[model samples]
Target: MRPIHPNAPGHGHSYSRSHIPVHDEAKAHLIASANHSRIVSIAAQKFRRRENVIARIRLVLRILSLLLCSGILIVLGQAVMVYYKHKDYVVKHNGTPDLRLWPRGLNMKPTLVMLGASVAATVASAVLGVASFSKAVRHITRVGNVVTVLFSTFCIAIWVAAAVYFKIDDFDKTKHYDFLSYTCARRHDQVLDNAVGNLGNLCAQMRASWWGALAESVVEIVSLATVVWAWWVGKRGGKYQKIGVEMLGSG
Candidate 1:
């Protein structure tokens, strides 16, 4: 008020000294706020990118799991078809069912039953497994695993029964049949006796060898292993989800 300078406030000044620092501080705060906003925007963008990548990975895994289940189902179906066809052939021909068709050394009927059951169970498991791959039904994996395990156990039991039967069926002295005319009058009786003897021996040998039973056991074991593998995969997927969450959080 004594002598107002040209640059002093309330005179012909641009700004007061006290206001200068305040303006500088305000500018600095604005710049800092802008910088913070930029950083936050960049971080958000990065987080979104990471989330997209994780989602893709999870989708791929789910597809792979579905494919695996489909493959298993196909295999089971084929096996069942072959078994039924062979069974039909034997029934039509009125011949003793070829024990060879039943896994290498198992009892015939038990093997057939086990294989049939396995096929049915495998189909059911595949359906459930596929359903589990869906985001909405992932919880079905546990049920699928249980069914698979049960099917495998049944297969093992079938093999065991076949083995027991094989132990009782004798192969040696088993008779062969020829539907042709015979020369000797006693040929018919001899042939018949031989056939009965051969069948008895074959049965005894089948009971003794235990090949069919072993086949069922092996198949069951594989089924059980598959179930275990599926369970592990599901667990791994759960871990991946946690990792994905952490990745997003960090981003």
Candidate 2:
């Protein structure tokens, strides 16, 4: 081996100039790799955060959906029961006493029609609301949620109005029957009085429908407000999701 100088250009103690370029390249590669890893980690974390938010929103929506369905079903069920009970009363008392003096009790067909409309609207609203939560169609979802909220509000309003009207009508009928019973009783007609009294008793029993109607109205109004709130929240969530998508795309 040759004896090398201490300041040799490419030998012994002197660093190779070529190695500096390689070292710089290695350092650049390492920095780029670290940047890529950091970006990936940040993206993953953001995705997870968005997913958690969406999951929480979905959970809240499901709970609201259940409550809405339950409330509507309960009101509808009670309306149906009242309809059947009234029908039975009318049929059973067809030939008894002087019920003809008073106006006939409520006709159930109109109530049925109202209930049918309300149920149909509510079902549509629920279906749309559920569909609106899909990320693939978030814009459509926003529109659908808006429409659903409107429909739900309309249905609730209709039901509340109908129930209030029905309650008022029931009160009127009750008053009429009471007067008839009192008049017949004062006339010293025992058989007629007994029949009228029994009929009045039936009317009194039906008074509970008024209370039920009021309760249903309150529930429906609250449900309407909740649906509106959900719609607003969903809209906000959709906006956030859109922002997230844009950020991801840009990144």
Candidate 3:
């Protein structure tokens, strides 16, 4: 006389309302977890791009810095060679590439002092580049950048002084009728037998020094600045943390 049970013999059994809801809730939780996990994964993937971009930029800057350092050496060497080749002719006339404008302080090779400074700066920059590639130590990069900045600044100052000292003489130019030929006359060595070679050598040195000071120096400064910027960005103190529902829940 009691109401027939659903599971009674020959009776078809259907899911109970309470049990059905339980299974539905379990399935819903699984789906939600999967969706949330995917979203988190996607977000993480996107955030990684920012780091990648910074790394790529840093690499490019390192390459450029290396090239600039090389330019400093190559250009300065060209200038030095020009002076060396023609200086013998000038030396006989008691002419020195002396820093006559400045009082003798170190008793060093006057014209070579600037070139030496450039070598030091370029070497320091090259060392920094190597260190950056080998190890990304934050303090090291900061210190390196400071050194590079100071050296590069000094380079600019010396470049200006050297430019004026090595300028072409106007009176001589009028006489020689050519810039290179005039610089040769300024050498004050009339005893040189090879007139053509003397003019060419003196003129070459003058132009090489001028171009090194003007073009290569500019690139070196820019390279130093870029290195500093890259280091600063690479050692960023702040990170952009993305707020997420999962993080909040976990908190």
Which model scores highest in TM-score? 3
Poorest 10 consecutive residues of model 2 by lDDT? 176-185
- lDDT: the better of candidates 2 and 3: 3
Better of 1 and 3 by TM-score: 3
Clashing pairs in 2: none
- For 73-156, candidate 2 gives per-residue lDDT tens digits of 555556456435443332125567534322355355434544564466457546655765665322324554455456546656
The C-alpha stretches of model 2 lying farther than 4 A from their native spots are 1-20, 88-97, 100-114, 121-251
Task: Please report how far candidate 1 places residue 234 from its true position, in Å.
Answer: 1.1
TM-scores for all candidates?
0.35, 0.40, 0.46
Q: Lowest-lDDT window of 10 residues in candidate 3? A: 99-108
Backbone clashes per model, in order?
28, 0, 0
Best-fitting candidate, measured by lDDT?
3
Q: Give lDDT for model 1.
A: 0.44
Looking at candidate 3, what is the lDDT of residue 142?
59
1 versus 2: better lDDT goes to:
2
**Candidate 1 residues 104-200, lDDT tens each?**
3223443344345444544644564565455443322555556555655754664466345423323322321111111111233433334233333
The list of candidate 3 runs beyond 4 A from truth reads 1-47, 81-110, 135-240, 245-247
| Ranked candidates (TM-score, high to low) | 3, 2, 1
Task: State candidate 1's TM-score.
Answer: 0.35
